[model samples]
Target chain A: MASSPQLGFTTASGLEQDLAKLIVDSLRLEVAPGDIDPAAPLFGDGLGLDSIDMLEIALAVSKRYAVELRSENRAALASLRALAAHIAQQRTS
Target chain B: MMRSTDSQMAPVPTARRAFAPVAAPAYPLVAHDSPGCTLAWRRDRMHSVEEFLRSVWGLAAQLPPKRYAINVCKDRYLFAVGFAAALVARHISLLPTCRAEEPLRRLAERYSDAYVLTDHDLDTSMPSFHVTDHARHSSGSMKIPFIPADRIAAIAFTSGSSGFPQAHAKSWGSLVLGAKALGRQFALSSSPPRTAVGTVPAQHMYGLETTIMLPLQWGWSLHAGNSILPADIRTDLERLGSPAWLMTTPFHLKAYLSERTALPGLEGIVSATMPLTRSAAQEAEHIWQVPVHEIYGCTEGGMLASRRTADGDAWTLCHELRMRQESGGTWVKGGHVGAWLQLTDRITLRNRREFLLLGPNYDLVKVAGKRASLAALNAALLRVRGVSDGTFYWPDQGRSGNGRLSAFVVAPGVSRAAILADLRRFIPVYFVTALPRNATGKLPHEQLETFAEQVRHSGQARTIHECRRESFETEARRGFSQGARRDE
Candidate 1:
């Protein structure tokens, strides 16, 4: 069995928190955004998100930030923090 | 003008040779003759057939002695290479759509000697081979091996109505023939080689047929990236030198239409996995100035029939294939579909060459290309501990384009998230006191809908659509919706 993601750590603020909320809203996930581990993996065992969820997340991210989350750069989807960092980098670029 | 090898075969010791089985004919691994023709596109750079053959040989030499290879390469180029390498090494490629650990574990348990061939470092308990490491190795002989036509090349699995993964094996000849038929159906064999840019993963049967086999057989280049984003698709299309064919699904097409994504240099579009609405297909054709074709098939038989959805509803069967109605069901055979296979959809035969698809069978529900029967889902739900009685409801057929299945359960202590974990999908779960099952323990059509409507109103379940009420009235008046299951 997979382990549950660590919840209620240090409060996730900034873009990381916002992206987390976006994921929850887009996928209709049962967990709260603040409870999500910012550093935990977004796929596989972390939050148990599948490929469909990834597409939904990509769509939501594009709509919200206007940043195209190309699936080729898979590292951007490693975690909430990674995704936020990618968005920040893309915005600056 | 009849030619026979009977005289040549008579020379090999008549008594012993007569009892021995005839050898299956062998065909070259790569169908195209041109070595310089482009085979794959890794981002902006094009890789030639020479490079692809070298990679196949290089990877085949380095592969571990395993009977089956669970190929999970994300890049289409790498996946093609790994698949070909496995075939050359006399190993079967096991293609599973789901990459989740549970499904992988099931595959591992089923195929004991199977090892994972992946580009990334997968967190799997099974033995793994990093295919990308040897993808560029050119030291080995680049000779294109001739594989026996009867050799089992790959096994594709589908989530059966019984909730277990059902395997469908395809021989090398069947795959090659299927690709040829598909190309002929689209008249691609006669046209210049065009790059295939697919939004679907290469692991799926539809993807494997169009994006992988069609390219390899017809000497076309396949885009390595599996990007569905509008910006990424436009960029990829712009970078291609040759005209491209977009192998996509309705979901992606709808997204593209909504975003008004400009796809340039596209020769045509092929949509599969789910029914593409006619309006969407017409709109796509109008905007892109390319014909939009939809393929109707399953994992069991690849590329059975196709239709230009913008033109009409009737589907033209592939070359050399035949379909007939028998015992109130549609059965198809011929061409790459070796034997008669009953389709899950309720179909109407227009003539010998074409047919009109009514819809998927009452029990079958396809969401975003993943097919699962409501019975299978209910069985999975009942297996969950603390669940007493439950039934999965498919509310509207028209809304299936963006439909979300709702389930009603009688589990008092079981949390919603726990059930979702068991099902492995996020669905709206309505906790009910009990299912309104008839005396025969079957969920009647009308009673279930009334019960569901009452529960949706009384509970905290947010209405998914305002138009849902109208659809319910419309369905009730129809006496029986096309999506309704009679025996459930």
Candidate 2:
């Protein structure tokens, strides 16, 4: 199961915070890392990243997390919390 | 034809089915029964040729005797029936890009006498048939409809860059013969029976050729309907019972690959509508565990060349077509290509069999699968209300995975919401940033990201389109300096 992306969720782990920053920086998102509700959907309506953004995010995850972001693993992208969990679980670094 | 990377649509030999010549000089385009082969698959059952022809005849009897009929049957199987029925009744099939009522009405009105033939439940009271009613019609006999080779089989319309859609008249011979060539490319002409499932709508030329014509002429079965979601596609494929081929677009293919659902094993994925990015294609092959072939063709040219995207960038020309690169475009002839047509894509010839797709022609700007002229988009933007003067310039940033065109708008008193909502009704745009023009009346393309960044920083972006420039046209020309962004 994917982890929840919330401010207080998962004890606000340093890795999650780090992943959040990575996403914002990679996407050139204007929002502060703390402001982007970790639990919010990374795709439509939340941060509102489209498919192209997802590709860039995948590339970033591959570089930073040292994890292969397979196209089939969409659940890992559900939220920042989910992404952090994915990176933590799958990270080679 | 290049490689048999597919496991599903494999030329795993079945009894070779040969098309015997017609006794008469005049030939029937669609056969009532194509010599001991099933027509299509529906509800996990093989719909025999007799039943398929009966449905065609039943629909043909109901259609008003006219020169053309607008074919928009969403169901792939029904569309095949409608297409053949139109040919049987001596009515040409008129295909449009969208199934919306306005376009269909305009097309029907333009053609003088025509009716909508779709499976969808539409609200319009246009002279139309739902196509579902003819499924149970009895097969009276194996009577075939003979059509002259010169007759217009289908009149396909392409969405114009600026104005109304342009019509390309395709004769029965050209469409049929072209499908035969495409069949060889797909290994559809040979036996071992593969069922095709496509995501694209039936109206488009790609969909028409792959889903309808191929199934009708060649001995292949169709999945009966369009599949979108991964689960839905898997369900349909499972029903078709194996050696399934997916004829889809890159847009849908990307989405399908992203899904967590376990995709059913397939023979191959033949993608058209847009160029498949190498990464996307590789990812698809990785997940689906199958070869992904990308077809490079436009509505005007029909099916031209295909590339097994994962294998390499070079495209192998369709066997029947001959090509030569001359003066910035690849000129193609043969395979009933009508006239010697020049493709808008610039190609570098590698060998006799292959070439690489560099990009679209210098003038065309492609976003996602949709192609439009920058001049056209800019003109339309200026024509919108509440705009004294505005320029729509492409930005380096702001485009998302969906490939929506990004633009900078300079309209005062207009909210980004108002601009986007209004502009979307005209053209599909992704991100719109309202910016002030420089003193020289030129909008800075590079500063668009800053404006977008500012909008994102502020919860609401109600920024007005302001300009410092007193002299508009001179600065406008000077500001619009990007050669690639210029209206060629």
Candidate 3:
């Protein structure tokens, strides 16, 4: 799963790198892991992703990071950086 | 002996018929004894139509008085008031699909003296007015102005050929007649007044007719809240209480369904803007316990046909309209359409009234509830300074929820970043290059990774997040978060 950490996500700080790689791998977006900007917003506008996409991401994050993400948890779903921070605090892995 | 002038002098009484025809400029925009004064909702608050009229007359008094005005208010109530005020001021509303600065600027350039009206105080180059900027006026003892049925009321913008916005000029008579068709189609007159909540913006033609105009013309009311996450749609519906109807597009309906939030009770659902799949419509009917009636329409004509989307794909024309196909094209005449019209989609006539959507005659793409011409987007793509050749592609299936529009280009030495940046101005896009050793060459999937890497590295192209639009969205996000927390 961590195979091509040599580029995009691998260059980021440990926590966000893992999450970015997780999102890129799970959704199968045509962009690089590094391309999913750490501080970029995770919902709505910038991602061009809908809430349905977020559900897929949430399921993937729960399995990979071992943490439950509530849809109402604004901070946890705010952006990649915020999400990474929340995961760092709450991940049981 | 009676003067023909006497007939014109009196109020053209709205047809006493159970379902009646409305002449555009012939009758009052809002009837005198029409009874209900409830205008629409602005979030949780209910605004009265009387107060709405006061705002209209009040705002109309302050304007410099031009022949046309652009209403870009996001609040449905403000939009309603702005629209009515435009009519009262004898000005035509220039309804643009987007409130983006460039589009509004182009509209201002085209209309010359047209002013921008909105609730937000965004910096606009045109003469501008805010909804709250009105001098005092009274809602009481107000008289609804009778519009000449032939007067052009509004011009709706849609992407046409040549990559520029095309205008469909609609008159008050046609708009009113169209509303009457919808009222009859939905059986709105016999049923108790329904409170409509639309996910589509009121400025768009479908949104304008279904959410704003239908209710206003037919004596119902609307919820003023704007679009949020799907759960908020439920909140908006529940906030308005029972006997409510939903006016949304396939894109929004699918999103709201994913939330699985229950409304208090709904009368029915009215969807337009894009094709609603049978399954999506069925799911809504099964879960929300409401009949899903999809309005078949385009910017050129208002709501013309409707059908139970779950009942398969046959659409029944509004009882007043008739259709006949000529030269492989279907045309509709009569009622508020005001002229014999050509349809964008090819239709196979099932009878005098019902027909199936065979498919579009020309390519039109609806992504995330916005319909843009594929040819127009492609023309805009190739028009970009760096591009040699390009084309746009979106998912053919009903919104897979991935929601990203991709482009393929054949411009050698034109940095992918530059192409992307240029294209993003037209539509939010992600693209792959097929620049073989030859500029005009066959496309392949293998070169994507190498091309993406080069594109990512070249030029100072910015991610969507890096743009100024991101700040606006972030501000909106903060507001939505605050609202969500309160709901919690």
Candidate 4:
């Protein structure tokens, strides 16, 4: 589901947006989609999610994308832009 | 009798000095023959160490070449045997996973020919190599190979509480060093009581180091069973004899203390997993008359710091491991700190040598632009009278534009208003919501979302019990009204 094309979204961007929406939906964040900075921290200050939230997100991501989200990696935090890039890379390769 | 008195009473100081040889800094699993101590499994099963090792080695030889083995058994002997087998076979051992399936699949993907070595009873569909009864093999001294200490011994999975578990590769030397530091810090050898037992799973870092590794490395005998039931713990200690140490988690320790069982002789107790509350620590010590050693560590960083309750509040870092807080308030650089071992916890560094954890780093929530720690919120909730256990969860933002927190509590006697009043002391009114608990006393995260959905649809603030009643009434009324309409 493309929410909007003007969001400058590639297929990966669309996927990341969808995933971000899913995370927000699952965690029940009070913020709007427009408020979430793609590059801002989802864990600490920006989104303020805890380890349990991360675990829930990880499981959800794994079940949805068949991708393993390792907790110990910096890649775990990279930009929604980078996540989009990664998803695009995964999909293409 | 005069000659005996002359020899026996000849200044007791001389005899004490004679017995006190310079105690070498011993590693955790190195000490074996303590006075009145033998591996309980050996005594019960009638198998000596040499005999046990040979049998374990025999099993190792039977396995196919270069097979990766994962050991998940809670039994000390089985864990030891499997670890020895993996080493002897030069096969990689996969440490236990916190959440299975996805992580196991990832490991399977990496090590294509990996075989899980489990106890005979576990029904794993994956290709598994069963550990045979070691007693059946011949009685001979085990010729354990001198593998390089730096060799990647095993991969322990981090309990990634919010995501897929990550694997932390541990070298034998690093793990041994960490265990040695732990044993020393806890005074495993020099103390009055030398025995160590664990209630936590030995696969976890805290249990692995304190319970399994310390015994194997330092030669301290470990209790066979790993169960944490107070009765079982007391029984195991009595069976092992006095001056025993119980390695357990805050969860089990709290439960044990709550049960208020008459504890047997314990030299000390070591707690990990979650932070041990000061009140809990005091209660355990006061009730059991044993020192509670609080250990702080994670899979990525093997053994970080430990504090004996007798020594006061601060935790001293292990010998080799060092801690320095990053400018951003996270502790970094420990013994096993890998390339990306950034902690998920916040800590206040008193100095390089000691620090205090400030709870989960990511638990801070901004309500109407005001920052509040979720840990503080949950702690506040638990402080309320009659509130047993509670967790604050965020509601799905798509339906509700506000990212307010929803709470699931196991407060039996407390009313919703009372709980809200308690929360209101520290939190804003808009941040609170209600969620349901399943039968097992765990709030299924999905169910919380459903509760949130019900709240959103109904546009009402209903307690979990009230919501259930409303749903029941709605169903009953629909059934009756539909029947009357059809009859007319």
Candidate 5:
């Protein structure tokens, strides 16, 4: 289990939980959000997502947090945990 | 028979005139102080067409001698001139059928030392030439060497949705003549004030001709890059100013119209690549307050026809080409008489100059010896209640045995039973198979081929019921998990 942060629901784990669900819903993922391991890849082997899915997720993230996601950068951080962190950083900034 | 040596080296007078720049009084052709094609990268520095060509030539001269080169730039000016320079330097330009990695690799193997021309710096193993640099200079205008009019100048690759990407060669003289016909037909002589803004890549036929070739041969300004998003398109159009024409596809046009945002002034919108639905065209015209012109062309024939309105069925053939259907219900023609070409489309010729295309010939499929059109099947699928966008994909098992068709659909609120119920009305029980569509509303041919191979090896007839059952279950689990996460 990942360590929980000080703010209770504001922790990275909490953020990942919310984000995983959001991504799953937006892309119509075949697996449960909980079943999506935070560290596992969101594309290819782990989630079987493609470029179109990436575009959708990028649009969803942009709409939700008012943050723009560059497609070229997405390949490096296509994981639930990384996405959550990116979103959280944007929210704070 | 002593073949005249002059025929090989002599420039066909008619063909030479075809390559001449059209005289446009409104947009006068002016010389730039800078050299090469300048892509507006920043506010201060813009690359010139002359300079861009020089850079490409400089790079090509330095690289090891190669037979073929493939350009993948979205920019028309860069792609056209880059291609021209390569041909002028006596190298072949291989246009691959698909941009997919596997097909690209295969094509690369077929053509030795093939280089990919791109605008942005790409970190790949393939040899690449970047024309973005402004410093490079090319040699002076040597007399245009005469290659046979039928000599292959550029090879265009197809979008391999159904199978492996196939290569189609376009000759210099033939391509030039085709552009001349298009320019004359569209009255490009008047210099339509509308700067060309393309939503599709110049790598494709429609984009290559309308956006790139038109500008190069006719001197119309073209937008520098591919604008995919609706907002980006709007921004680019506004920046280009009045009398702007959008060269785009049906897919992007649908999305653009759906955004419902105030668009800039437009002279016209050219659509191709996929069939444009009547509803989509009407909505676009309504939204933009301009005519949505439909271009009926493919990778093989280049620009064939253009219709001003979506409902308009008759397509005016390009000035030089004549259309006649063979006795076997296939479109066959010989005018312009460059290459013997057979089209994959079924067209109805109203006369010598006009015709109405009835979709692609291959789009028709046979199930249990009963022929059914895939276009009709997919059209029925879209008509289902709550279905937003859908495409039908024939599964691998359907190749050998008596296999039914399968479809992949995207419907937000529609249930599986509701969709099945709707489909059952049009298609027979045996005809309906499994439909699996990818996110982009396109099926990967590789995946289908793999599935076919698996079926052939296993010797199992997978029922449509099994496929649909799995699809429904997957959708349900996805929906449930998504709902649960959102609730938390």
Candidate 6:
């Protein structure tokens, strides 16, 4: 998989890139997946995504990875890296 | 008659004072019967009526001396407290449809003395007071303030044609009456009190009536978090110790049913903001084991009618309201609606107390000498197998030079040709990942128009023949070379 690295940071992981693409595709964001900073916040100030976008992203995640992201576990939505970690942990568990 | 006049003459100064009307009738802030009753659920913790009143007083004292409070608090509980605080402070709350910069700028331009009452930091040039920081647990007396009935409580705004905020001022009496009517419509008092959990934002008029006001008027707890995701809603409902009534929209309902989201301790579901297809409502009722009720109202007025989707099509008017047909339009007055307000929807009055909705007046489209509403066409599109979400777009012939109707659909593994065939029409069908529905699940006219322009220019839109000629080929094989014919 093609992974894009941000300046002064390690290269984006495969799962992080996959999640970036998923967010872009599901929310129809104009930005390319590689342009997304994996460490940047996925909602509000960083990506500026709203609650409706969150719902769409959650549904897309559930459909693709079979890992349900609930708002109770809001940490999973902190960033692309956090979401990737959550998905990985869920799959392993 | 003589005895009645004699009694009137014998009235002392005290008796005369009792008969004289006060400056204005005062309505209590909270309508709950007891102080210990649960007013709101902040996360997993419930705030009693007494505690909520104290919070309101504390917030009211901390509020800046402003005439208008632009309430943009996201949390429903904080929103209620801010709303009550503004009332106690004798300030009118300004509810804008959105928190976007442009809308807020316009609101600020209109109300120069306004300040934002928010839960968190907001990017605005206007002065703001963070409501969360002022949520004090005051040890003051728990005396509920009585607001004058004629006082202007809040001013709600809708996007006007000119892109300016159109204000609708509501009085304290009218708001309370509307809340009471809403409670009576559901017969909420007939059963034990249930928490009001909502997927809609508390700012929207429908959301304000059902989630914020209904619970307060009927002594039910209001869920603070506005969870729209299926998993989130499930978790939120699970955390509630008491049974809850879900105040949601058709969009949220469809998502939950599709995912088979398990919502525990839900006694009922109220869907609004848009029309709910009968099939979807029936499926939700069957799966969730709760009666699915749909409310019919608009921003100009609070809820006016409601019906159990599983019951019938006709909507019974709220007991306090009356409707009449005048000059080919339906006007509702009485109860909460003080003035005779003409509804924009083309309605057929079934009787004095019930009416059948015929969709919005502007939604009527006549094709091939047959009349059909865009809502019905969209519903039909959704009913097609494998179709996830869709909308029928009728482009303005004057601007686009193409009057032909087109449709945008989000259906994976479904071909554009197949969708067109199922729709029984040959038109431009664009396969998209998703529709740009707003937070309330409403696809605004301007947004749809812009989306259509993008789709046309992006080469993503395709005609039926361009997609697949297989139907024609099959017809040719059968010796009917006249091309695919529309059944319609």
Top-TM-score candidate index: 1
Quote the true-contact fraction of every model. 0.30, 0.00, 0.00, 0.00, 0.00, 0.48
Residue-by-residue lDDT tens digits, candidate 4, B331-425 = 55645453435666667778777876653223545342333445555666666677667676665451122455556566776444555534422
- Candidate 4 residue B89 Cα shift, in angstroms, is 1.5
The lDDT of model 5 is 0.59
Best by lDDT: 1
Interface RMSD of each: 3.3, 8.8, 6.6, 12.4, 9.2, 9.8
- Each model's DockQ score: 0.24, 0.05, 0.08, 0.01, 0.10, 0.26
In model 2, the runs with Cα more than 4 Å from the true position are A1-93, B1-36, B360-404, B407-422, B425-488
Each model's lDDT comes to 0.80, 0.66, 0.69, 0.60, 0.59, 0.78
lDDT per residue (tens digit) for residues B395-417 in model 6: 76511123656789999986444
Models, CA RMSD each: 9.4, 12.1, 11.2, 22.3, 13.0, 13.8
TM-score of chain A of 1: 0.85
Worst 10 residues of 6 chain A by lDDT: A1-10
Let me know the DockQ for model 5.
0.10
Best of the two (5, 6) by DockQ: 6
lDDT of 3 at B382: 76
Docking category of candidate 6? acceptable
lDDT of 5 by residue, B416-456 (tens): 55565444321222221333446865555666556544544
Chain B superposition TM-score per model: 0.82, 0.74, 0.76, 0.66, 0.64, 0.72
Measured by DockQ, the strongest candidate is 6
Off by over 4 Å in 6: A1-48, A72-75, A78-82, B1-24, B360-488
- Worst 10 contiguous positions by lDDT, candidate 4 chain B: B1-10
lDDT of 3: 0.69
Error of 2 at B9 (Å): 39
Candidate 5, residue B293: Cα displacement in angstroms equals 1.2
**Model 4's lDDT to the true fold?**
0.60
What is residue B405's positional error in candidate 5, in angstroms?
Answer: 7.4
TM-score for all predictions? Answer: 0.80, 0.66, 0.72, 0.57, 0.64, 0.72
TM-score of the A-chain for all models: 0.85, 0.81, 0.79, 0.71, 0.81, 0.85
Error of 1 at B74 (Å): 1.5
Q: lDDT at B298 for candidate 3?
A: 78
lDDT of 3 by residue, B1-488 (tens): 11111012235446654444453236566632343456676666776656766677777777767888798988888788788778767789998877667778878889997888788987676788887556235742345666777777899987875578889998888888888888889787524567878777888888888888787887777788764455566567767743788887665676567656576767788887667789999999999888999988878888879999899889999998989998878999899886898986768899999999874222566443345677677777777666676666553332454445556666767544444444443234343354433354633233533554466567533445444365356546555332101000
